[model samples]
Target: MGARELTIVLLSAPTDCVDDDRTEQSLGLAYIASTLQAHGYSVEVIELTGLRSSELATALHRIPAVDVYGLTCYSTNYHSVRQIVTHLRSHHPGAYLCLGGPHPTALPTATLEDLQIDSVVVGDGELAFLSIVDALKRGRRILGAVGAIAPNDLDDLPFPNRHLVDQKTFTRTLNHCRTLSLISSRGCRHRCLHCNSVVMGGARKRVKFRSTGNIISEIRELKKMGYGALRFSDDNFADNPDLANLLSAIAKEDILYRVFSRLEQLEPATVQRLADSGCKLISVGLESLNPKNLRFLGKAGMLHCLKNLEHTERHGITVRASFMVGLPYDTDASIQHFFEKASRLPFTEYAIYALLPYPGTPLWENPERYGYEIVDADFTHYVQMGVGRQTAFVLKHTDPETGFTFHPADVLRWHCLAHDLFSSKRHMSNSQVG
Candidate 1:
């Protein structure tokens, strides 16, 4: 048989952290792999989402000889990506290695220069990746990266290949396995000071969307394969203009799923439609309870989320929300107010994270302006967990004027406190409302 041109790709992170085994599947890799396969190149997606630290090097070695290696990662995981890329290069000296995703897109030059990386893709990787492969096949001498162009007509792109996830290694929700993640749109309309969406693209957001027909086709295929749900991973799920039609189609099928949404966008009619359409959970960003902090995070006020939460609960929709512990707008009092008020909200599930000054965000660019000192400058300390292991680097912050310091440990304590406050349901499994 003739030699086949194969490319190995990954959607991964360092497996050093605890709970890494239960991480979610990388939908991004599936999309890119499908693109490469559509172009007639053999593709293999090597996911490290739930593997041991020692398994990464061995896994790369075992893959059949391939022409290129591709990876997508967050800034926190880039440290381990470096180690794997080194292993890939050492094993296959001629293979072209490239990096993409939030971290590489934001810092392409540095990411390429710091390691044995051959190139980096700065934006949406579907076409950019195929282009890179063509260039590599032609054997053309290349520079560092190819900039991004947001695909305006999403339906034109091929469906993401879920076969790459033929094995189940990622986290499950409501007893479902990696039930296909669908990105209905790209870029966000809001310009939250902390969000990196604008930096990845431009402030214009370009908000492109897929047609309802296209999404329905994939949902049908999933249901036929015994998959019962879909996770809509859109940055702004509600903003899609075709949402009503999309929901209608989803209802036609018996699919149960969830999404990230703006609580403010939900009116009575929309929430009612979602409930009837088999909506199981909605994960909203409840950044803070303070009106001032809410506005700072690019929200109008707290009333919208509060009102919407009540509306969702009445419809039997479970709400899972998240709050940031240490926004620059967060004073000690405001942080306390967040936890205190959160326990009273309609949501039963919650997550708490210390603020991250990731590369492309305004907070990361100008920490002092936000009243944060960033006592730790290393990017490796950027995960929701930390580097080396979970909770390794305590991100220190100062009030600047009051000399008050916030330790990373304090963030953990508040999370524990929040959980304890909700111990009745989470710890005890008592779902009865007294």
Candidate 2:
């Protein structure tokens, strides 16, 4: 098999148009491709965002015969992955099919039950992907094996093969600068109940960073290629203390960028440093304002987060705060309180999504306990737009008193509408300022 030329194809599922306006490339799959290339495999990474299931089938039919096919998916994309697997089995029966990323890692047994997926690469796919390719070449067993790879060892992995991504598609979808999504680390240190990162990667919270020199070098290369800004896709940028140093180093090189952070992690000094370092925007996960809801969601540092919102805005960085509604304890009054608080905050952009219970999260593991009733089994509906659990609500009829009731879908839709309105307002304000 080593003597023969191998054509490996990596596929990302189509994005739901209702989710958001921003387009994101499959940076995770890109990392997998990079790893395979380092281990001597020829690979092609494809984005299925704009393609229908049938289109994907047709495209798979036209591609040159490949030795291996790798796919990435989240809970919202499981159905698409299943459909692709079925098509691949019917058309390219000889091609080895492997599944990775959040959904597969969370539901490995269920995924294997399909029989279309030859193997499931659990946790980080970098080392496992390379090992599978190598083993396949040697006619070794590679299915149903768990790769207990550590996140701290991420520095050993090669940078993502950006050349495989469609540059025009990325530019058009993101609708911003000519940018590349970069991951400086893996695994979140905080325990967000609804997040699957800890469940898949483990709770030890291992973090990795590209060396300061390495990051700067990559930025320089992108700058030479006429790229404008970078989208740092790390789960929590401020989780690492050296982030300031990294920002300083990039600033020294005059590199422009954007990044995501947990609101609680921001400090005035750090916010100022980030702005000074050419950061045009910062996204913060402001999941909820209700203290009980926040506690239920396992969010730490609620007060710090509120303060950080003000601090970041004062520093002149565009703050994009993401909020969630329709949790188990959410009430109409509580949600209204959230909206009022959000209006007063300095966040220039707002992303409001319904509480989605994905397969692997703690919430999904024990939904009944959280007063949530599972409604949809289809993975496509698992997108933030789909209503998951019928949340039991507790409301406050007056500001001084708290009351209780239940109406899940309505609560979810209200939050979605609020998000849309805020987003539209933010965009208009930005345009006006420009």
Best by lDDT: 1
Regions more than 4 Å wrong, model 1: 1-14, 21-24, 175-178, 199-204, 329-332, 385-405, 424-434
Instruction: Put down candidate 1 lDDT per residue, 1-434, tens digits, no spaces.
Output: 12445555554555565454444567778888888888888787767666667777666666555777788877777767887788878877887788888888877777878887778888788888888887776766355877765566788788888776654655555434345577777788778777878665534446777888998888887777777777788876777787788888889998788877888767677888888887877778877777766776677555555788888878987777766666545555655666676778778766555667778788777777756667677776665543322333335667667777767677666555655565443321222210
lDDT of 1 at 190: 79
Candidate 2: tens digits of C-alpha lDDT, residues 26-100: 878888888888877788987877665456666656655688988887776677677778878887888888988
Query: Which regions of candidate 2 fall more than 4 Å away from where they truly are?
Result: 1-3, 16-22, 172-176, 200-204, 385-405, 416-434
Cα lDDT for residue 246, model 1? Answer: 80
